[model samples]
Target chain A: MKFTVQVNEGPYQHQAADSAYQFTKAVLEKGHEVFRVFFYHDGVNNATNLTTPPQDDRHVVNRWSELAKEHDLDLVVCVAAAQRRGIVDEGEAKRNSKDAENIADGFRISGLGQLIEAGIQSDRVVVFGD
Target chain B: MSEEMMDDEVVKKMAYINRRAPYGSIYALESLEVVLIGAAFDQDVSLIFADDGVFQLKKDQETAGIDMKNFSPTYRALEMYDVEKLYVSKESMTERGLSEDDLVVDVEIKTDAELADLLDDQDVIFSF
Candidate 1:
């Protein structure tokens, strides 16, 4: 089955992001296709490349990036939410005249329409949030 | 796509899992918007009220003091949109001391295990 995962909370602050990541990993391991992982609300924070966690902690952002890279997954961060939370890609940074870009690897910032499209295309859409 | 074309597509079971109260945040209201718009796409949709989400269906909500519009009435319009499958968590209601009488809409009250079964039947689950 093709599944789209929606994450609606920031990492560490809530278990939503972690649950979403684990769920996605589990789906992929089961040989199911993850159509896309759409991040909305505070979940957009997962796309920031600027996060620097301590050595012992599991790097949630890096985990998502690595997973996406390994599975050729489409990781989408909502543009409206990302802009509000300061998670900007190179294009958005240049367009908005921002000093630096912060979007992490393997994630693309897009509109909410991508979310709706995911729902339309995927066989199942599961959300993890607060 | 045109409405006629949309009607030809396979209908998927989708549920909007409301887990928060109204006015506290934007999730409740936004989820409602999605449900409204999604109904037009001709999918089999339902709303699941769990945790603090049951608070969103409480009757006699007045937002005058908070300066926010009272959207409780919007739930009433859900039926008109053909989006009437509403389920409330009995455990959540009991936990919050809320009964069916407190709710604005008539809903099927389900236990946690039954709700889990219903969730398992869904093709899509949107939590907000």
Candidate 2:
């Protein structure tokens, strides 16, 4: 089945992001397909492209990016949420004339419509937030 | 594309709203895990972050001072897991002197009216 998962909590605040990550892995292991991921609220931080964890850390950012790349998932960062938090892509950074860009790899910038669309298309739409 | 072309039938919608801060608590994280498990079962999930919940997404968070490993940096890693439908109330943001620029993620900053409309559309709503 096609699953659309939405996570609003960014990394490090709590284990919500990690749990969501594990759940996705399990879903794929069970032979399920993930249609897309819509990050909003604090969740958009999950797409920041630049992050370095210490040697003793879990490297959560890298892990999520790896999962997206491995599964070819559409990691979507909400456009309004991202721009406000200074999480921008190459194009957005240039357009906004922002010196800093934070959106992570394997993630794209999109609108809330993508999320609503996901809810309408996927057999299931799961959300992890707050 | 317009929603008109999408599936007309209303599917089961599940939401896990996280209303906690990033560094000073654990409830927000634990609740998210349960929601993900539920989502794995083919449930429709949506997340709403109101109040201080917006702080959970700031960049460069370190927990060394609190003698706890700062986990705020983990917010950006939700994509591999596909949990992306996140929402925040505009009123909440404004109440706390926050705007779209204060959060780490891109969220739907809707008015109470819009949230009410969205909530009404949900077949089921769960708050945490």
Candidate 3:
């Protein structure tokens, strides 16, 4: 089966992120294909690249990047939501003359169209949120 | 193979809003899991977070400080599970003295009014 999953919360302070990941992993482990993964709300901050956890902490950013690459997934971060929290991609970083590109790799910085498209394109639209 | 297979099924958009930190309790994570179960069957899904919910994305967080499990890392694995739409409120980040640099993953940020607009778009909303 194919699934479109949307995550609207982060992993740190929000358990929604972890729950969402587990659900996605379970679906794929069950041999399901994920059509798209859209990030929004506080979930948008999931794309930020400048996270350095404590030595003992779980490295969520690295994990997300790995999953995206391994699964050939489309990680779409809403551009409007991303920039509002300072999650800038290479283009936005350069455009704003910011010293950093906080957006993560293997993810597309895009609009809500991708989300709506996912809704229209997937067999199931599962949300892991709060 | 195609999304159209579920077109005949009713589609409703549900937004899950996370408005707290990563630790201190399970108020946010557990609540979200309950909803994912529903999304698995029927309904479209959207997740949103405002206010303190933005803190949930901070990178490299150790719940040891609060005697909790470090679950933030689990978020990165969400894509593999097929849950990928994450949102944070722009105003919340600003008020919390955080920037995208402070976060640990990929996300979308919106302002107060925009958040409201998104809530309007959803058929159901859950907040933590």
**lDDT comparison, 1 vs 3, better candidate:** 1
Off by over 4 Å in 1: A90-101, B1-8, B64-70, B77-81, B89-120
| TM-score, cand. 1 | 0.74
What's model 2's TM-score?
0.55
Question: Cα deviation in Å at residue A18, candidate 3?
Answer: 0.8
Ranking by TM-score: 1, 2, 3
Per-residue accuracy of model 1 over B64-126 as CA lDDT, tens digit each? 999999999999899999988999999999999999999999999999899999989987778
TM-score winner among the candidates? 1
Candidate 2 error regions (>4 Å): B1-128
Tens-digit lDDT track for model 2 on A1-130? 7788878687888677888788888998899989888777677777776767678988777787899889898888878778766789988989989887777778899776676567666766777864
Give the alpha carbon lDDT tens digit for every residue of B36-95 in model 3: 443454456666767777777787787676677776676666555566677788889998
* TM-score of every candidate: 0.74, 0.55, 0.53
The CAPRI-style docking tier of model 2 reads: incorrect
For model 3, the local distance difference test gives: 0.72
Q: Candidate 2 — what's its lDDT?
A: 0.71
lDDT of 2 by residue, B1-128 (tens): 33532545544665656677764665565445445444444446677877777666655566677887655544555554566777887888888888787666667787867877777777545444
Among all candidates shown, the one with the greatest DockQ: 1
- Best-matching candidate per lDDT: 1
